[model samples]
Target: AAALISGHEDAYDGFICDEQSVPAAPGEFGVALDASLAVWQQKGYRGIWLKMPAAKAHVIGHAVDRGFEFHHAEKEYVMLTRWLPSSENKLPPNASHQVGMGAFVMNERREVLVVQERSGPLRGQGVWKMPTGLVQQGEDISEAAEREVLEETGIRARFDAVLAMRQAHGFAFGKSDMFFVVALKMEAGPQARELCMQEDELVGVRWMGLEEYLAVPFTAARPLFQKIHAAILAYVNGTY
Candidate 1:
């Protein structure tokens, strides 16, 4: 720490203290605060940054009470500044939600556009899998899924109906993520792959019949996908 400070004079435009130390308890935070203030004073530092992980809104409010303000970095985390008077970083007025969106893009003959992920933590890469995405801003899950199928597989789709919603919990990228299971009815023409590929995110996209999808094995979430398909079949048959 000494070497970093002395070796590079005026090197940092300003500093971001990702963390000063592990978070202290309710009363102990005052000690950390005093210690941090001392360091800032002695070092001739002009600004301080703090990171509040998770929904520590009470702690954040306390920090604001101590004159810290927060800025949103992304959907997942916030960056806080302690050099200025606090202001509200209230989450915007739009209602936010998370949902699973998926599709069974079947043609008149019942073929579907299936995509296989090429890389990353999930298995079944480069194999047959349904097109899917998470519902985003202004997106209804049903409509979001249709857009996902079209974006991932280049197949214009129409929904049959929602099939199911269930909790899918598993490890990927070294952490557990839960997803909602959703299914929809869809139809596409023979030219399903006529559009450009979202190549960085997908390796291959193709149309396959239910028998073919069932024939080829999937890795994680395979059972979930299979169940969605079965439900879609039932829905299309007027039984579900």
Candidate 2:
């Protein structure tokens, strides 16, 4: 309400009431909408279209008093839009997923940017894998991906294409992981050239062929990577 009554006029097009967090009392359409619009009009606002349940028309009628008109109605919702002819439409950014985020470190490859971890849970682990990491709070998946890739392997990478999004399942030695199969355009070579191994965490970063990745003993992977590997190869061959 402060946004409507005290902010800049023409600052917004109209307000969208996503949730009726404040349900109106019975017989208060005029009391609610007209009063609200009057406050907004003072700021030079153009119009406001509120999507409320049709069952709440008594509260909507108040808007009609302030030049608000009915635009549409669906199920229990009625959309009332009032024009002040000056207000601009402003929308908030979409909410991010509630679940945690993660990314895949791709290498420039006509093939694959794979690695065999030197340390961690599978110590002396020679399993081929795509570089991936968990996103920390306040950090985007891409940012975390780059940081983790650099920390685990000395490879610097840019996210190319997203190949896969595995929900409901992923692997982790500590935190939960939401692996995004990202692509990195890279030339085939030694992964160690860019290896920034956190000696306590990883041992090696080896770039290898897709077939090699598939053939690495199953003992070197978590269930998530095995599936990711299958998905990746499907792309390598342009099959799936």
Candidate models: Cα lDDT each: 0.59, 0.56
Q: Per-residue CA lDDT of candidate 2, range 208-228, in tens?
A: 665665666762367866676
lDDT of candidate 1 at residue 118, scale 0 to 100: 62
lDDT of 1 at 1: 21
What's the C-alpha lDDT at position 225 in model 1?
Answer: 60
TM-score per model over all chains: 0.53, 0.44
Q: Look at candidate 1 and tell me the lDDT of residue 110.
A: 67
Candidate 1 residue spans exceeding 4 A from truth: 1-97, 168-196, 219-226
Model 2 clashing-pair count: 26
Candidate 1 positional error at 219, Å: 5.9
Q: How many backbone clashes can be found in candidate 1?
A: 2
